[model samples]
Target: MSLFSLENKTAVVTGGASGIGEAISKAFAGQGAHVHILEFNAENGERVVGEIKAKGGKAKFHACDVSNNVQVTEIISAIGTQSYINILVNNAGIAHVGNLEGTAEEDMDRIYNVNIKGVYNCMHAVISKMKEKGGVILNMASIASSVGISDRFAYSMSKGAVLTMTYSVAKDYLDNGIRCNSISPARIHTPFVDGFIKKNYPGKEEEMFEKLSKSQPIGRMGKPEEVANLAVYLCSDEASFITGTDFPIDGGYIKLNG
Candidate 1:
């Protein structure tokens, strides 16, 4: 059998319309799994599903807001009724760039609702269905989840929750054959990063981009496809012996950056 092949599996990927989530959705489908993309952006969702289909991969898009429990539950339930969900990639999260004093109540609440609670909502909605036939869960954590990143109070807090939730779920569902793991990425090069630089740094976009890229200690930002490749391996049956682990896809940031 080919390594990391997900043939006949049914996978759900939240925020699958863009960035790392988009890469994971395409990769999963390319490996023979039917992908269900849960995304808030209908335009991007349809575009991604179209791209996947164009590549001869099976994919469907569902208009979803991961932060809304009712919506998440209904969507997952409907998908579960149609097919057994063998893999779930919780990649729906938002970022905040602020320290404690810079963070406002609304800012914290917004981060909490999407980053932390969204993970909970999707996992909660799918756990029972996965319990019936065993499945893999991959949460998109961050370097902030483990290390202290300056000016990221709220973002770090939310991701810290994601990291711990991965552990708790992995431990709790072991007997049920559910394997849960998290990927802690450093700076990943995405459209969001470009926009963040353009919005925050203005004319110094190139300067700020280089600064952010070099912060990873490898002199570059990670590619979404690289992270998606790791996601594929972890979700595949070859990784059956692994569980409750946090895989840092940081470019030497976690260990080498001092």
Candidate 2:
């Protein structure tokens, strides 16, 4: 059997409704893993699940506001009892464009709640279960984690914590066979990009999109499936010896550009 095979495994992806999260969910299902999507958006979540099912993949939906501990704990616990949570992908996050001086207190709190605390909550809820079963954890960090991006003060802060948390968790659980890692991606073409364009650029949406796409040295944004392919590799047995590291799937933005 290929080390990439996920035949007997199960993966839980928060924010599995769209973007990179959607791609990861579908890819895991394609690898023969049972995928359960936890997302705040029921409509998009159901749509993704439907697509997976149509392809004869195994998947389900769980409505979630990952920032809410009570909700995350209760739902994850219920799911844990039925089957071991083998692989957990913490992909639930939001982006904020503001520096320290321009960012609002409310906005900072919101970013911390959903971006930082949200990952913490879900990890806390499932870590013990994962330890018992010796599973994998993949966090969706960003280039903001290591390098400063313009007007991303709060976003950068949260992602830095994510990268560290990946290391911290992986270190603490090394003896238990639990592995944790993070993926830092540069700009990717997703609904969020479209929405940002529509809301901010309006008539100049295409122009702004092209600008964002070219921000990467590779001259284009990444596709969700590309990110997903890397994720599937990291979570599979092939990466069993790989952990405590952050994989930058960015288009040479971190190194080549520098």
Candidate 3:
């Protein structure tokens, strides 16, 4: 048997309309899983589903705002009615760039709603159902989750919650045949990165990109596919022994940078 094959499994991937989430969704679908994308971007979500279907993979898109518990719950409930959910990738999140002094209360609240509470919302909606037959959950954390990063107070706070949540859920559900974990990626080269550079640095976009890449200590930024590959492995049955862990696909950023 192929160790990483997700054959006959059903995966729900939040934020799957773009970037790392998109890569994970496609990777899971390619591995024979029925992918359900819970995304806020209706157009992108539909397009992704179409692309996956055209490639002969099973996929569906649900327009969902992870911060909205009512909407999230309703969508998950509807999905549960059709398939036995096996995996959930909590990748829906927003980014904020500011230190504590620079961060306003509104910034903190916005980050909290989407990053911290959003993960909770999705996990809460799916846990009881997953308990019935066992499942895997992978949360998209960041290097900010564990270490200090300048100009990222709100983002860091939210990801810290994600890390702890992974541990708490893993411990609480030990007997339920559920495995929970988080992935912390540093400086991934997603379109979001490019856009941030373009909007913030403009003429210095390439300069900023290089600086960000070098910050990782690997002399380059990570690819979304690299993160997705790890997600695929962690979600597969081969990783049944893993739980309550935070895997940093950081290109040595966390350990080597200092």
What C-alpha lDDT values do all the predictions have? 0.96, 0.93, 0.96
Model 1 lDDT tens row, 1-258: 799999999999999999999999999999999999999999999999999999999999999999999999999999999999999999999999999999999999999999999999999999987998899999999989889899999999999999999999999999999999999999999989999999999999999998999888899999999999999999999999999999999999999998
TM-score of every prediction relative to native = 0.99, 0.98, 0.99
Q: lDDT per residue, candidate 3, 31-140, as tens digits?
A: 99999999999999999999999999999999999999999999999999999999999999999999989999999999999999999999999999999989999999
Q: Could you arrange the candidates by lDDT from highest to lowest?
A: 1, 3, 2
Model 2: per-residue Cα lDDT over 45-71, one tens digit each:
999999999999999999999999999
* Deviation from truth (RMSD, Å), model 1: 0.6
Record all residue pairs in model 3 with backbone atoms less than 3 Å apart, i.e. clashing: none
Model 3, global lDDT = 0.96
Clashing pairs in 2: none
For candidate 3, the per-residue lDDT at 166 reads 96
